[model samples]
Target: MKPKILDRAIVGASLLGILISTYALNVEMAIQAKPEYKAFCDIAEYLSCSKVLSSEFAKGFGLLPNESALKIPNCIYGIIFYCLCIFLSSFDKLNVIRALFGLALCTIPMCLYLAYLLAFVLHDFCVVCVSTYIINGVLTFLIYKKMKVLSAKKTC
Candidate 1:
């Protein structure tokens, strides 16, 4: 496989993830600003971005709660993660590929955990969140495939 092709795939997936995360962050902000705010992502009672975004977990793990001025939305991390992936993809170094692979590998478990929380604990689904998870999965797969190709090339 061509490295350029893999780079494009990674960049494309990262950009899509960024867009989805941005939308989720906006919905989260709206929910915080107005208690009565209903986001379009609130498709149904069981499938509501508002419910998930408003939950305690949405603030993510940090020293300060989301109510604190220093706190940031969890989606902000997604945006940064995807952006970093995109940035890393610009380089053709094996180290860059390894970094991307490591980042993607780390994200898979987090996505799985969040998916479990949505399905069981939260009992609510955020379409935007799910979409981002799917994107992350795809990104990981692409990175793995790219890594395999790079390894093969290095061996040969």
Candidate 2:
């Protein structure tokens, strides 16, 4: 596909993924605080924010899980994704490479965290957790490809 078309699709998908995962995270948070979203709470049972969100380990690598730190990993990434989507979809679109770089830059840490969770903590994964993983993985690839093309063009 043409790079522009491909990029628009990627940006759109990333925005959707961010929105969905934000909802899932909020659902998980709800499960942590209350029992309201019973169905969502039920599916995210394996995630157990009680364990993942409120534990010493959630802090990660000697870093404490404060508002900014947590926001950096989960919250800001979503906002960045949304803003990137809006920016690209608007008249002055970003180059595919720049978008891809931004995307991978946002998502790689998440991929690391998810992998860590898989390897050490959560023996089994939640459906939402797995979906988030897949979405991040795809975003990483899409951005990587776009960046590669862009860089190649610059060299040529």
Note the Cα lDDT for every prediction shown.
Answer: 0.85, 0.56
Taking all chains together, each candidate's TM-score versus the true structure is: 0.90, 0.63
Q: lDDT by residue for model 2 over 86-137, one digit each (tens)?
A: 4554432237457546755666676677668655766545555455567667
Q: Can you write out model 1's per-residue Cα lDDT over 1-156, one digit (the tens) per residue?
A: 787898898999999999889988889889879989999888899989998988777766333665687467778989999999899878767777898899989998888888888889898888988998899999999888888888788889
* Most accurate candidate by TM-score: 1
How many pairs in model 1 have backbone atoms within 3 A of each other, for residues 3 or more apart or on separate chains, i.e. clashes? 0
- Which parts of model 1 are misplaced by more than 4 Å? 61-71
What C-alpha lDDT, on a 0 to 100 scale, does residue 32 get in candidate 2?
62
Question: Any residue pairs clashing in model 1, and if so which?
Answer: none
Per-candidate total of colliding backbone pairs: 0, 0
The runs of at least 3 residues in candidate 2 whose Cα sits more than 4 Å from the true structure, single-residue gaps closed, are: 32-37, 44-62, 65-76, 85-106, 151-156
